[model samples]
Target: MYTYTEFDEAFVRNRVAQFRGQVNRRLDGSLTEDEFKPLRLMNGLYLQLHAYMLRVAIPYGTLNSGQMRQLAYLADKWDKGYGHFTTRQNIQYNWPKLGDVPDMLDALADVGMHAIQTSGNTIRNVTADHFAGAAADEIEDPRPVAELLRQWSTDHPEFQFLPRKFKIAVTGSPTDRAVTKAHDIGLRMVRNAAGEPGFEVIVGGGLGRTPMIGKVINEFLPKADLLPYCEAIVATYNLLGRRDNKYKARIKITVHENGLDTFRELVDARFAEIRGEFSGVDQKILAGIEAQFAPPPLRQAETTSFEVRYAADPVFRSWADTNLSAHKSADHAIVTVSIKKQGQTPGDATSDQMRLLADIAATHAYDELRISHEQNVILPHVHKSDLPAIYDALASVELATANVGLVSDIIACPGMDYCALATARSIPVAQTIATRFDELKLEHEIGPLKIKISGCINACGHHHVGHIGILGLDRAGVENYQITLGGDGTETAVIGERTGPGFAYDEIVPAIERLIGAYLNIRQSDDETFIETYRRLGMEPFKDALYGESARSGRAHAA
Candidate 1:
């Protein structure tokens, strides 16, 4: 984790002071609700359906024990007893009093954290692979580049008020865990012909009402040209992107309206115009940032204990199988603590659970923690020998659900329950699906599956990328659900295809069950996952299973 310098500290403190005054003014009637709206949004505060929600940025999803403890403290003291981790790897407190938000901001600042750029049209928190530093297959840690972007974009005058919110994601691994293709700007670290580490820059990708997999604008962007090139892209978008309609304001829309070739030409021209402005300053800063992210000390440890435990305990084995990933070090393992427990809100973590994770990280995980876009917590550097103890500690807090990539491990946005933009409920549907899957004891059998749900087309839950995507909608004053299949959020990014008509809220769980049941029967073998079968066989069979033979035949006849 990059420690905040004196300048960083001073800047955050000043911002906090400014926001505190704004909050005071709003409370004292000096500012109307409309007047306060943008100000509050700029500071990561949202007036939701029920209460104010505060979103705090966990930059690149990295945190230490102290920071985690502070988040836990804020959740317990000011808001509800739990906090919601979001798909952007940030955390949200759904029930905070308007007046207490300043205090919350101050408390966050105390731990070198803040809510700045967590909302609004400014560059939101720059995200990266949660397994960046620890993944075995990474060419380089992406966090340094992510941090460089965060520093460069924070309060950049040119981009402070863009046409719409901008998101950037970076991944150093060949396997794209960060959903890089679905971001406004995606950087996949790759070695060029000369074997120099550089980025394959993908632009214009986003998930919302119009979901798109980003197009590769630059096949090989030199490592040194990152900052200026990014500036060129954003600056071009700022000038060309739509301002008249919020619905079409995003850069993705701009890219869609103008052909990619034309957009590339514009970006190239802009890059040439402003590339001199950088003058190697950002590269220098990037070098310094890279130093801060060096891998932690590797300690040689025996994995015999872990092996013995795995052989002895079926329960521990189940959790380990789903929750652990390969680590860069032979003796270490990356542990993903599933926040999506069966029957619980997908990403809700109680204060105690947060504290417990903090303690576990401090003791067993080299004091490093990561929040995944999948709404899970990760201990990225746990020694294999510590697996049993860590598992036991996590189990105590009900964080030991062994469904990391399974059906029960879902990604859900704060839908109608909290979000003002949501037209239908998302959390309950996620909860019901997970609970039903768990009841069936079919999660493990189903193999790796990603089920993402969004309350609306905003796609905050990234339903567009899930293997089985569910979108909740309001139809004629009633909640309805829509399903999409074969969506993938990986190196081979593809938007999901919708399956026929929407289902009623009560019918959703059974519909999902029917779809999964159909998959199990139709798959080539148990080893062929839902996504594989969907990719090979396509949607016709799945549709038949979901809507039944009569309905499918009728729809075909109608078609």
Candidate 2:
């Protein structure tokens, strides 16, 4: 919600013009695909499986109604009829013409949004908690800091071309909703022993060929030192991060090789030298950004008896149980609009649905909306009394699925369907899993289970963090899938271990059903979730169920 200043406006305008010229050259054969690749990547354009995809950054996943409407406009006017909200809380338009991207950038800029730094080796969109400001459990709102990072990292001369793409995520809540440990740089807003809010800075965590949870670089980094410390970390990575091999280029490799103590020393040495340079500039910028995020005024009234409403309507009660969260205010609740329908691509929202959400946000939910890392949309501050109206509006648009935190509410990426890098179709696999579970009526019975799918090992779908993780792979030109068990995305985060042999494209769904069925049979009580049961009796049983006879074969094809 940060308003663009004159400086910000000028910068985006220049970027748009530059990209326009680049697109013109590409169209007229002045620039070949080889020449235009980096330029387009810098502008957040990618040549995907079918067409060019434009990834627009929704910084910190914060957007107003105007910006949402603009995204809807772009989806309707330029790209396909819908957009895909990503795990990073950004949006990808899968069918934008090369020439019209400049116009799309213009449309975004008109609403104070842009695609800059949404991709490439530079720092990607800074992500944070979707319920940052509105959550009752937050220590402080993290968007101001996320916004500050956005400004500081934009075309930063030193970090424009790092060894690999860098990601940073911040969260102010005790509950780790942002999955901070799975990012390149994780900032957990914490209160120091002195009771002053600072950050617990974690460095070098990432997922790919070599997954690592970040180590704490600094236990308590003062709020004022955020920019300088971050710069120091990026500078250190730029200088020492691996460039010899693309596979080993992430900061995780560097941190892992150098050891945390040595890396911390280097970052501290760099921080000491640059700390003075950031003295007043960041304070001024952060103050301005914080002002933009001031909470909307709420009318003083007695809290609604939401329990009474729940007792009356079973459907509403089911939805309220799954879709709503306790708000900071007494009479309000945070509503998560599940994009994971029973049998649809995860995170796909049609243009009309987007427009409808924008309208509803403006009318009933404080004109603010958030794109969550779970591939869902959030009405972050909805009054309890308005649930029925919001639910009706969202239901009409196919956004009111009551499956939040359920097994069927999976997170997946645009796999072979859109991503050129993908070797398998992740969306369809996720859809089939959801549909099968719904058919069995086993989702609610199974309780909270995170089933995340990644098209490839890049782990954009966060398969590494799911309670039940699925990884799509290519085996001898055929699509295959692997499953991992005991993974968790929480304060106590842990990477899952592979169950056994990979499943063929056709065999993956039934294999998943088999695993879930095994969990249900082995669970001591119906109250035992998949995660709890997994913790109680490791992955041995699930592995046996998934690979009944060929448990020791370790083949790519299940049968």
Pick the TM-score winner.
Answer: 1
Report RMSD for candidate 2: 2.7
Question: Global lDDT of each model?
Answer: 0.92, 0.89
TM-score of each: 0.98, 0.97
What would the per-residue lDDT of candidate 2 be over residues 375-416, giving only the tens digit for each residue?
A: 899999888878888887888988888899998899998988
Ten contiguous residues with the weakest lDDT in model 2: 550-559
In candidate 1, what are the lDDT values of residues 1-559, reduced to their tens digit?
Answer: 7989899999999999999999999999999999999999999999889999999999999999999999999999998799999989999999999999989998998999999999899899999999989999999999999999999999999999999999999999989999999999999999988999999999999999999999999999999999999999999999999999999999889999998999999999999999998899998888898898989897887899999999999999999888899998888899999998899999999999999999998999889999999999999999999999999999999999999999999999989998999999999999999888788788999899999999998999899999999999999999999999999999999999999899999988878888888888788988999899998999998888778865434322101
Give the poorly placed runs of model 1, Cα more than 4 Å off. 549-559
Clashing pairs in 2: none
> What is the lDDT for 301 in model 2?
48
Deviation of model 1 at 42, angstroms:
0.8
Question: For residue 100, what is the lDDT in candidate 2?
Answer: 96
Give the Å shift of residue 360 in candidate 1.
0.7
